[model samples]
Target chain A: MNWTLMWDSLPRLLAALPLTLQLVALALAFGAVLAFATALLRLSGNRVAVALTSAYTFVFRGTPLLVQIFLIYYGLSQIDLIRDSFLWPVLSQPMWCAILALALNTGAYTSEILRGAIETVPQEQVEAARACGMSRVRLFRRIVLPVAIRQMLPAYGNEVILMVKASSLASTITMMEITGVARRMIAQTFAVFEIFIVAGILYLLINFVATRLIKHAEWRTTPYLRARA
Target chain B: MLDLLDSGLTSGLHGWGPQLLSGTAMTIAVALSSFLLGLAFGAAGAAAKLSDSLVLRGLAELYTTAVRGVPELLVIYLLFFGGSGMIMAVAGIFGYGGLIELNAFSIGVAAVGLISGAYSTEVIRGAVKSVPYGQIEAARACGMGRWRILRRVLVPQTLRFALPGLGNVWQLTLKDTALISVTALAEIMRVAHTAAGSTRQSFLFYSVAALLYLALTTVSTTAFQQAERYASRGVRRA
Candidate 1:
C-alpha cells in the first residue's frame, strides 16, 4: 500500500466531500418526507390512495437508480414538450437529476421500512389511545409517529449508508461526487487501485460513524436492554 | 401519441435493441454462474464457520466480515483491476508465460460471485446452525459416516432454512450486475446507456431497462417463494 500517496490524495478527496455529504443528506431528508407520505397512503383505507402509493413504490424499487438517473437526465430531455415545460429548470442539471433519482429510489425503500415499523407498532396501543378519546391526528402524532420513527431509526441508518454507497453511481451521470473525484484522480495518476482504496476508506469511515450513531440511538431507545448491558 | 410511441419502439428495436438483448443474455449467464459459485463458497464457509476447528472458524469469520464491511462497488472495482494481475501472477507461477486474457463475462461473474459468496456465507451459516444436532447424533448412532451424516441429516435441513436468505442474495446479485457496466460488459444497463447517449433519449431506454430488471426480479421472487413453499411443506410453519 502506498501510504504516502494515500495520505496525499486524502486532502483532495476531502475537498469533494461536501458535495457527497450534501447529496446524501439532502436526498435522505427529502426522501424521508416523501416516504412518510407514501407509507401513510400505502396504509390508508382509500383504495385510490393505496393503489397510487403501491404503484409508485413498485416502479421506483423495481428499477436501478442508474437507469432512472439516465432517464431523467438524458431520456426526458429528448422530448421538445418536456424541454419546454416548467420541469426543465430542475431537469437541466445533473445534480438535480441525480438527487431526483436517489430521492425517489430511497423514498420507495424507506416507505417500506417505515410501513413495516408502523405495522409492528401493535394494535392494542392504538386501541388504547382511541379509547382515551384522542383524535386521529393526535393519535398518529403522539403515538404512531414516535414509535414508527424510533423503530425505523436503525433500518433507516442502513438505508442512509446504502444511499451513501449508491451516491457513487451518480458519477455515471457526470456528477463529480466522491467516486467521480476518485475516477478523475485515477485517470490523472493512472493509479486505479490506490485512488479507489482511498475512496473506499472514506466510504467505510462514513459508514462506520453512521453505524455507531445508529447503535447509540438503539441503545438509548431500548433502555431495558441498556440496563441489562 | 400512442402511434408515435409504437413507432419509436419499433425504431429502437430495429436499431440498437439487439445489443440490449445480448446484454440481457450476458446478465442472466453471469448472474446464474456467479450464483452457483457463490453457493459453493457459501456452503464451504458456512461449514467452516460452524465447524469445531478454530482455524476454519477464524477463516470463515474473516471472509464474512471483510467482504461485508466493504462496499459492493469497491469489491467489483477491486476485482476488475486486481483480478487480471492476480490471475497472471498465478499463471506465471504455473510456468504459463503468456498474456492473461480474461473476458468481460469471467470478470463480471467472479466479482459478483465474491459479493454473493460473502452474503451467502452468512445465510448458509445461519441455516447450518438451524439444523438440529439431535438428528446428526441419531445418524451417527446409526453407524452413518461423516459424509453420509452430512448428506442425510445436514444438507436437507440447511437448504430449507437457507432458501429465503439465498433468495435475497439472488435478488441482490441480480441488481449488482448493473455495476458491471464499469467493465463495459454491455449488460442491460450498458446497452441502455449507450442507446440513451446516442439517441439522447435517456428516459425510453432506462425505463425499458428498469422494466426488464423488475420483470427479472418478479419472476425470480415468484420462483423462490414457490421453492420456499415446497421446502417448508413437510415441516410446520410457526
Candidate 2:
C-alpha cells in the first residue's frame, strides 16, 4: 500500500470521471427510453411485436457485452453499405457506436425488469380504471405506468450499476472512458496496480452513490417504509 | 445482402469453421475445468464459513465479499498480469527460472477458476445453510463419524440444492471467458474478432460468434436443467 502513489493517482483518475459519467448517464437515459418501449412491445398482443422484442433481448443477453461492443464498433465499420449509408454519421464515431451498443444491451435487460414489474401490477387496478371510463392513455398514465415504475426501480437500480460496469467495455473500443484512461495511464507509467486500483476505486465511488440514490428512491416509493425509516 | 450472407456463411464454413470449432472446444474445457476447481474451493470455503469458529467465518466472508464486489473483468486483468509474476517469484524461491511460462491455457483456466470460486463460495454457503441442522445432529446421535456424516448426509443434499445456483455461475464463467480475449487467448470471441478484422466482414463474424455463444448456453442450460431434475428425483416438491 503505497500511500504516496495512491494519492498521486487519484487526480489523474478523477480527470477521466467526466467521460465515465458521460458513458454511464447517456447510456442509462437512452436505454431507459428504449426499454420502456421494448417492454410494452413485449407485452403487446401483436405476435410480431412480441417476437421482435423477444429476439432482440435473446440475442443481446445471450452474447457477451464485450462481443456486442466489438461487433457494433469494429464489426459495423466493416460493412460497405453501412459505411456509405446516411446512418454512417452516427456509426462513424466510436463514442456513438459504444453508446449505441451499451444502450441496446442495457435496454434488453431493463425491459425484462420492466416487463416483470408490469406483470406484477394488480389486474383489478386496470379494471377499475376501465370502469371509471378512463381512456387507455389515462389508464396507463394514472395507474399502470406509475405502479410499474415503482416496482421496477430496485431492479432498474441493479441494471444501472450493471451498466456502469458494462460501460468499461466501451473502453475497449477506443472510447477513453474511465477504464480506457486508466489503461492509457498504465501504458505510460507502467503502474498497472496503481492505475487499476485508482480506476476501480473510482467505479466503487460511483456505484456507492448510485446505490444510495436507489435506496432513497425505494424509500420514497414505499411510503410505508418511509414511516419505518 | 441475403445472397452476400449466404456466400459469407459458406465461405466462413470452409475457411474459418475449424478455428471456431477449436474455439468451442477450448471454451468448454475452460468452463469445465474452472467449474471443477471452483467446486473444490466453494465446498471448503462454505464449510469454513459455516463453522462455529470466528477465524474461519471471517476468512470466508473476506474471500466472498472482496471478490464479489470487484468487477470480473478487473479480476481477470489482475490475474493476467500478476499470475506470471507470482509464478516466477515462487520459482525463484525454489531456485529455478530462466523464464517459467504459465501458458495461455493455464492462465485462462486459473483466471476463470478464481472468478468461479468467488461466486461458488456464495452458492455453496447458501446451499449448506439450507440443510437443516437436525439432520446433522441426528447423524451425530447415531454415532456417525464426521466424515461419514459429511459424505453421506451433507454432500448429497448440498449438491442438489446448489445445482441451480452453480448453473448460473457456470453461465457467468462461460461468458467471462470471452473477456480473456484481451489476454490474446483465441477463444470464440477472439477468433471472431480476428476473422472480423482480417475479412472486414465484422457483422458476419460477430453474428456467428454470438450464435456460437447462444448455442453453447442453450446446450449447457438444457444439460443443467436435466441434471437438476435428476438430482431432485424422489424429493418432495412444494
Candidate 3:
C-alpha cells in the first residue's frame, strides 16, 4: 500500500476523468436514441425490421465490446473505400471510433432493457389509451413511454455504470482516459498494484455516486408508488 | 471480399483457420476453468453472506461490491502485474521463494474467476433463497444432518433456480476472456488481433472472431435450455 504513490496518481487520474465521463455521456445519450429506435423496430410488426433489430442485438450482445472496438478502430480503417470517404475524418480518430463502438454496444443492451420494459406495460392501459381515440404517437407518448421509462430506470442505471466501465477499453485504442493514464503511469513507474488499486477506487467512487443518483431518480419518478410510505 | 474469405479459410495459403480454431479452444478452456473456479468462490461467498457471522458477511459484501464496480480490464491488469509479487511473497512464507510466476493462462483464469464469482454469488444466493424453507425444516425433522440436508434438499433446488443466471455468467466469462488478450494470451480475440495486425485484413479476422463468439453463445444458450428443461422434469409449472 504505497500511500504516497497512490496519492500522486490520483490527480493524474482525476485529470482524465473528464474524458471518461465524456465518452460515457456521449455513448449513453446516443445509445438511448438508438435503443429506442431498436425497441420500436422490434415492435413495429414488420418482419424485416424485427429481423434486423434482433440480429443487431444478438451480434452486439454476443460479442465482446473490445472486439467491436478493435474492429471499428483498426478493422474499418483497413478498407480503402471507408478511408477515402467523407466519413473518414470521424472514423479515423480514436475518440470517434471508441464512441461509435461504445454507443453501438450499449445500444444493443439498452434496447433489450427498454424492450422488456415496454413489453411489461399492461395491455389494458394501452387498450384504454387506444379506445380513447388517442393517435398512435400520442398513445405511446402518453401511456407507454413514461411507464416504460420508469420501469427501466434501474436497469438503465446499470447500463450507464457499465458504459462508464466500458469506456476504459478506449484506452486500448490509444484514447487517454482514466484507465489509459493508469496504464501509462504503470509503464513508467512499474508500480502496477498501487496505480491500479487507485484506479479501481476511482471507478468505485464514480459507480457509487451514479448508483445513488439513480436511486434518487427512481424515488422521484415513482412518487405515486411512494405516496403511502 | 469472397477471395479474402476463401484465403483466410483455406488451409494451405495464408489461412489463419488453424490458429483461429486453436484460439477458440483456448478461449473455451479459459472460460470453463474460470467458470468452475467462479462457482467454487460463489458457493463459499454465498455461504458467508448467508452465515450469522458479521465479519464473514461484511467480507463477502466487500468482495462483491468492489469487484462488481471495477472494470474487468483493470482487474486483469492488476492480477497480471501484481500476481507474481503476491505469489512470491506467499512462497517466501513457505521458504520456497525462487521467483514465483504465473503464466498468462493462470492469471487470466484467476482474474476472470474473481469477477465471475462476484456475480455468481448474487445468483446463487438468490437461488438459495428461492428454495422453500419448509423442505429444509422437513429434512431436519426427518433427523438428517446439515450435510445430508444440504445435499438432498438444498443443493438440488438451488442449482435448478440458479441455472439460467449461471448461463448468463458463463457468457460473461467467455466474453471477458477477450480482456485477457492484453496479457498476450492467444485466445480467440488475441489471435484475431495478431492475425489482423499481421495480415492487414482486419475486417475478415475480426468478423471471424465475432462470429466465433456468437457461435459459442448460441450453442451454450441451447445447452442451458436443455439443462433447464431437464432440471424441471416432474415439476409442475403454472
Candidate 4:
C-alpha cells in the first residue's frame, strides 16, 4: 500500500463528502415522508390504497437501485412528454435524478420497516388509548408513532447506512460523490487499491459515526429498558 | 411504445429479445454461483465466529464488519482491479507469469459472494443459536459421534431456521449482479443499457429490464416461501 498516495487522495475524496451527505440527507428526508405515507396507506383499510402501496413497494423494492437510477437518469429523459413537462428541469439533472431514485428506493424499504413496526405496536395500548377517547391524531402521536419509532430505529439505522452506500451509485450518473472522485483519481493515477482503500475507509468512518449516533438515540429512547445499576 | 416493443422482440432491426434472454440466463448463473460461494464462506465464517478460539472469532468479526460497512460497489472495484495483481503474484510463485488475468464473471462471483457471505454469516450464526442446545446434548447422550450429532441434531435445525434469511441473501445476491455490469458483463442490466443506448429507446429497454428483475424477484420469493413451508413441516407454530 502506498501510504503517501492514499493520504494525499483523502482531501480530494473529502471534497466530495458534502455532495454525498447532501444526497443522503435529501433522499432520507424525502423517503421518510414517502415511506410514512405508504405505510399509512397500507394500513388505511381501503383496498385501493393497499393495492397501490403494495404495487409501489413491489416495483421499487424488487428491482436493483442501480437500474432505477439508470432508468430515471437516462430513461425518463427519453420521453418528449417528460422532457417538455414542468418537472423536466429537475429531472434533467443527474443530481436530482440520483436523489429521486435513491428516495424512491429507500421509500420502498423504509415503508416496509415502518409498516412492520406500526403493525407490531401493542394492540392493547392502542385499544386503551382509544377507550380513553383520545382523538385519532392524538392516539397516533401519543402512543403509536413513538413506540413505532423506537421499534423502527435499529432497522432504520440500517437503512440510513444503506442509503450512504447507495449514494455511491450516484457516481455512475456523473455525480462527483466520493466514489466518483476516487474513480477519477484511479483513472489518472492507476493506484486502484490505494484510492479505493482510502475511499472505503471514508465510508467506514461515516458508518462508524452513524452507528454510534443510532446507538445513542436508541439508548435515549428506551429509558424504561435501562438497568437500575 | 407498442412499436418500440415490437422492434425489441423482432429478429432484425433493433431486436434485443435474444440478447435480453441470454442476459437473464447469465444473471441467474451468476446469482446461483455467487449464492453457493456465499453459503460456503458463511459456513466457514460462522464456524470461526462460534469457535472457542478468540483469534478465529476476531478474524471473523473483522471480516463481517468490514464487508458490511463498506459499499458493495467499492468491494467489486477493489476485487476487479486488485484481484488481477494478486492473481499474477500467485502465478509468479508458480513460475508462470505471462500477464495473467481474472475474467469479469469470476470476479463478479467472487465479489458478490464475499458481500453475500458477510451477511449470511450473521444469518447462519443466528440460526445456529436458535437451534435448541438440549437437542445436541440428547444426541451426545444417545452415543452419536460429533459428525452424527452435527448431521442429526445441529445441521437440520440450523438449515430450517436459516432458510428464510438465506432466501433474503439470495435476493440481495441476485440484485447485486446488476452492479457487475460496470465490469462489462452482459447481464440483464448491461444488455438493456447497451440496447437502450444503441436503439435510443431508453424507456423501452430499461422498463423491460425492470420488469425482468421484478419477475425474477417475485418467482424466487414464492419459491422461498414454499421452501420455508416445506422446511417447517411437522413443526408446531404459535
Candidate 5:
C-alpha cells in the first residue's frame, strides 16, 4: 500500500540484480559441468564412479542450500588448513563460498534431472547408431546427447529458476544480492513489506524471463513436433 | 587431533547434541503443522480451480502462480512482518483493543503453509483431473451423494496419484522450514547457526544439520513409498 516507498525501493533492489544474475550464471555454468559429469558417472560401468556420484548427489540434495552456504563460508574458515592453503584466497570470499555451495547443490539436483532425461532417450536410437558402426562417443554425441538435451530443457529450466531462488540464500552470507539489499533497506526504513515486495517482484521478473527463454528453447529444439504454420 | 577434526568426529557434538535434537523436533513439529495446513489449502485451491466459477478459478490460479514464481524467503518476510498487524486489525473488529502476540511458530507454519500450498495445489489438481470422470458419473448413477462419491470414488484414487507429487511437495515443505530460521523460531538451522557462532565449530554443526535434514527426507520418502503401495493395493499398474 505504501506506493511511494515501494517505488523508491525498486532502484536499490535493481542495483543488486547483477550480483543475483552473476551468482545464477556462474553456479549454473559450474553446475552444468558438474551435473554432466555426475550423470555420465552414474551411467559409467565403473562401480567407483557410480558410487561416488550417487553419494555426491545424495549428500548435496539431501541438505538445504542455506546449510551448505554457511558450512562453506563460516564453516570452512574454521579449518586451519583451508585458511593456510592456497584455497584460502578464494574460499575466504563470501561470494565465492556462496557460489561454490550453490553450484554443488544445483549440481546434485541437475545431475538427477539429466540422468533421468538421458535414461528416457530411446534405446532403439542408440541401438541403431551402434549397429551402423558409429563409435560410442559419436553415437552419444550425434544421437543420445541431442535427444536428452531437448528432453532435459523443461526440467532444467525448472532447475534454473530454482537456482535463481537458491541464489537468494547467498544473501545470508553477506553477498548483498537482491534479497540482501532489500533486507538491509528494510532494516533502515522499517518498510519491510515495501522492500520485500519490490525484491520479490524482481525475483518473479527474473523467473518469468527465464521461463520464457526455456519455453522458447523447447519450441526451437522440438521442430519435428511442431504443427504447420 | 587434526585427523579426528577432519573426519568431523562427535567430539564437537559432545554438548550440542541435545540442543540440535530439540531443534530438530521443533522443525518436525513446524513442518507437520505446515504440511497439514498446506494440504487443506491445496484441496480448497484445487476444488476452486476445478469449479465452474470463473472468478474462483482465476483467484486459485493467481495464488499458485504468484507464490510459485516468487522466492519463499520473500514471502516469509512479507507474512512474518505484515501478518501480525493484519491479525490485530481483524481482532480490532471483535472489540479487542489489547496487544496480542502471535508466536513465531504459528507465523512460520502459516507462511510456509501458504507457500507449500501453492505447490500442493498443482499436484492435487493434477491428481483430481487424473481421476476418471466415468467413475464419478457411475457413482452419481448409483444414487450416491456428492460427499459420498468424493469419499468413496474420488479420494482414494486422488491419494494414489497425488502421493508421488505430494512427496515432492513434502520435501519442499521440509526444506522451506529451514528458511523459517530467519524468524525467532528455534528450529534446526537457527540452532546450528547459534551453535556455530558460539562454539566456532561451524563445519561440525552444519554438517550435523545437513545430516539431520537428510535423515528426515530419507525417512519420509520411505514412508511415502509405503503409503503409495498401500494406497495402490489391488490396483493394476503398467
Candidate 6:
C-alpha cells in the first residue's frame, strides 16, 4: 500500500493547508453575511424582494460550482467592459474569482437553511416579545434571531463542511490549494495514488476539525441541552 | 455593444446547438446511470450498516465518512487516472493481460455513484430505522418469513420515508456530474467549455449552460415532488 509514499507526501500536502483554510474562512464569512441578508429579504413580505432573492438562490443552487467558478473567471473575463472596468483588478485574479463563486454558491444554500430554521422558531414567542413593548428591531435582535441561529447551527455546520469540500474546486482555476498542490505533485512525481491519498487525509482532517467546532458551537448555543458541566 | 452581444448569441446558438443538445443528453444519461448504480450500492450499504456485525458496520461507516469527507473532484481524479490500472489488475487475476481502457462516462458514473451511494446509505438507513417495529412483529406473528416480511412490510415503508432524502441525493449526483467534465467527457459543461473557447463568446455559452442546468433541475425537482406525493399516498404528514 506504499505506506512510506503516503507518509513522505504528508508534509508536502500539509504545506498547502493554510491556503485551503484561508479560502474556507473567507468564503464562509462572506457567505454567512450574504445568507443572513438573503434570508431576511425572502421573509420580508415584499413580493419584489422575495422574487429577486429566490431567483438568486435558485440560480446559484441549481448550477454547479465549477460552472460558477468558470463563469466568474473565464466567462466574465471575456467581457470587454469587465476588462476595462475597475472591478477587473479583483475579478481577474483566479483566487478572487474562486472566492466570489464559492461565496455566492454557499450563500444561496445557507440562506435556504436559515430561512427554514427561522420559520421553525415559535411564532408565539415573537408575539410575546412584541407584546412586552419591544421595538421591532429589538424584538428580532433579542428574541427571533438568536433562536433562529441556534436552530440553524447544525444545518449551517453541514453547510460549512460542504463549503470546505467545495473549496477544492478552486484548484481547477489555478489556485494552489490542497487539491491543486496535490495535482501539481502528481504531475511532477507521477504518484497519483499516493499524493491523492495524502491529500484526502489532509482534507479529512480539516473536515473532522470543522465537525468538532460545529459540535462545540452547537453545545455552546444550546446550553439548556448540555449537562451542568 | 448590443450588436456585439446579439451577434455572439446567434452565432453560439446556431453554431453549437447540436453539440449542446447532445451534451445535455450525455449529462442526463450519466446522471441517471450513476443514480441507479448508487441505489444498488446504497441498498447494500444500508444492509451492511444494519447487519449485526461489527466489521460490516465499520466498513460501511468508513466508506460513507471517507467518501463524504473528501471532495468529489479528488474521487473523480482517482478513478479517472487509476481506473485503467485497477481494471487491468482485476483482469490479470483471471489470466487476461489485455489492456483495459475505460471511457470517461463509465468512470464518471462509478465515481459519482460511489459518492451518491454514501449519502443514500444514510438516507436508506434512517428510513429503515423509522419503520414501526410492531409492524414487523405482526408480520412475524403472521408466519411471514424474513424475506417475505422485508418485501411486504419494510420496503414499502422505507420507500415512503426515503423518497425525499433520495431526491436530494439525486440532485447532488446530477450536479456532481459537472465535476466529471474534468475527464474531458462531452457533457454539458464540456460542450459549453469548448464552444466558449472557440467562439470567444464565453458569457453566452456559460449562460446557456446555466439555463440548461436550471431546466434539468426544475424538471427533476417536479418529478421528485410527484414521486414523494405518490409514495406517501395514505400516510399523513405531521
Against the true structure, whose DockQ is highest?
Answer: 3
Candidate 1 docking quality: incorrect, acceptable, medium or high = medium
TM-score of each: 0.93, 0.91, 0.97, 0.97, 0.97, 0.97
Candidate 5 clashes between residue pairs 3 or more apart in a chain or in different chains? none
Complex DockQ, candidate 2: 0.55
DockQ of each: 0.57, 0.55, 0.81, 0.80, 0.70, 0.73
| Candidate 3 C-alpha lDDT tens digits along B74-152 | 9998888889988998889999969877999999999999999999999999999999999999999999999999998
Predict model 1's lDDT versus the native: 0.84
Give the DockQ (C-alpha) for candidate 3. Answer: 0.81
- Per-residue lDDT, model 4, residue A125, is 100
Candidate 1 chain A, run of 10 with poorest lDDT: A220-229
Q: Write the per-residue lDDT of candidate 6 for residues B1-238, one digit (tens) a residue.
A: 4555578676657579999999999999999999999999999999999999999999999999999999999998888888888899899999999998999889999999999999999999999999999999999999999999999999999999999999999999989999998999999999999988887877878888898999999999999999999998897779
Q: lDDT by residue for model 3 over A60-132, one digit each (tens)?
A: 9999999999989988887778889999999999999999999999999999999999999999999999899
Pairs of residues clashing in candidate 1: A74-B202, A75-B201, A75-B202, A75-B203
Candidate 4 CAPRI level: medium
- List runs of model 5 lying over 4 Å from the truth: B1-12
* Lowest lDDT block of 10, candidate 2 chain A: A220-229
Better of 1 and 5 by TM-score: 5
Per-prediction fnat values?
0.56, 0.49, 0.80, 0.81, 0.72, 0.71
Clashes of 4: 0
Once model 5 is optimally superposed onto the true structure by TM-score, how far is the C-alpha of residue B185 displaced, in angstroms?
A: 1.3
Over B26-118, each residue of candidate 4 has an lDDT whose tens digit, in order, gives: 999999999999999999999999999999999999999889888888888888877898788888999987997889999999999999999
Evaluate all candidate structures by whole-model CA lDDT and list the values in order.
0.84, 0.84, 0.93, 0.93, 0.90, 0.92
Error of 4 at A13 (Å): 1.1
TM-score per model for chain B alone? 0.93, 0.93, 0.96, 0.94, 0.95, 0.96
Q: Model 3: residues >4 Å from true position, as ranges?
A: B1-13
